[model samples]
Target chain A: EAGVVQSPRYKIIEKKQPVAFWCNPISGHNTLYWYLQNLGQGPELLIRYENEEAVDDSQLPKDRFSAERLKGVDSTLKIQPAELGDSAVYLCASSPRASGGASDTQYFGPGTRLTVL
Target chain B: AQSVAQPEDQVNVAEGNPLTVKCTYSVSGNPYLFWYVQYPNRGLQFLLKYITGDNLVKGSYGFEAEFNKSQTSFHLKKPSALVSDSALYFCAVSPVYGNNRLAFGKGNQVVVIP
Candidate 1:
């Protein structure tokens, strides 16, 4: 089966511009996650979705960042008025968690590299 | 709060020799640990995980990790290193189940010289 897929592998935008990244999780997977990865650092969770419902988004910057997992299959992460600090790689991941077990390993996509000027 | 720490920024090992990458973690209750590898400009690939049972857990690409509850460490190891094994390795931890927000360390760069 194909792994997680994401679009716009790279994005370049000016400060205050709007930027968006898209993701499509593996078929039949019930959970999806969006992560922001700064240079030389590990990914930090921005939002998580179980089906179409966002179960966790405590870390998301709601002031200008928003996400939507429509139909529980595809997801979009958007940032309005992007700042220079927002320039980073956005990673999307998914996993099959019918049992919600910790053994379920998350599979990741290539990720979208966004650069804000 | 849960957190992971990778003491080394880089680990160099001669090909065909054993290699080890160290990781330490702190979490509340039982700990669920994971190791992931990433190539340049690519996403992370799951290497292994420790949920329960044996402390020694084997995973993809000849990688393995030992869960030391006493020391709060889950170090990744390989019996014989290969050039293809060179990559950035991340150690992550989750305090409980169904919480996908795994606290990850900065990462360890592994270099295997042929």
Candidate 2:
């Protein structure tokens, strides 16, 4: 089976511009996650989705960052009026489920490298 | 609050020698620990995990980790290092059956030299 897939491996935008990244999880996976990874740091959870519902988004910057998981298969993460601090890798991952004795190994995508000028 | 720590930023090992990468975690409940490896410009690949049973868990590409509840550590090890094993390694943990949110360490880069 194919692993997680992401589009536009790199993105460059101005500080006040908008940028978006896309992700497609593995087939039959029921959970998807969006994470931000600053250089030299680990990935941090931004949002998580179980099917089409976003179960957790506490860490997401609602002021400018928004995400959507339409059809429960593919997802899009958008950042409007990007800040220089927003320059980091945006990683997408998926798993089978998040409950009851299930394996919780997440499959990650190559990630989109976003640079804000 | 769940958190993970990797003390070393990089680990160097000669090829054919044993290697180890250290990781420690703190969580409220029982821990679900995982190890992942990432090659250059690639996504992270699952290596191993420790859920409940045995402390020693074996994983992909000769990698294994020992879960120590007392020390709160889950260090990854390999019996014999290979040049291809050089990559960035991450240790992550989530509280048992808790919110599926994972706390990850900063990651450790392993270099295997010939």
Question: Each candidate's interface RMSD, rounded to one decimal?
Answer: 1.5, 2.0
Chain B TM-score of candidate number 2 = 0.98
Error of model 1, residue A3, in angstroms: 0.8
Docking quality class, candidate 2 = medium
In order of appearance, the predictions have TM-scores of 0.97, 0.97
What lDDT is obtained when candidate 2 is compared to the true structure? 0.92
C-alpha lDDT (0 to 100) for residue A84 of candidate 1: 94
Ten contiguous residues minimizing lDDT sum, candidate 1 chain A:
A96-105
Candidate 1, residues B1-114, lDDT tens digits: the string is 789999999999999999999999988888899999999999999999998999999999889999999999999999999999999999999876546468889999999999
In model 1, which regions exceed 4 Å deviation? A98-101, B97-100
Query: Per-residue alpha-carbon lDDT of model 2 for A36-63, expressed as tens digits?
Result: 9999989999999989989899999999
For model 2, residues B11-98, the per-residue Cα lDDT tens digits are 9999999999999999987999999998877778899999889899999999999999999999999999999999999999998866
Compute the DockQ of candidate 1.
0.73
Clashing pairs in 2: none
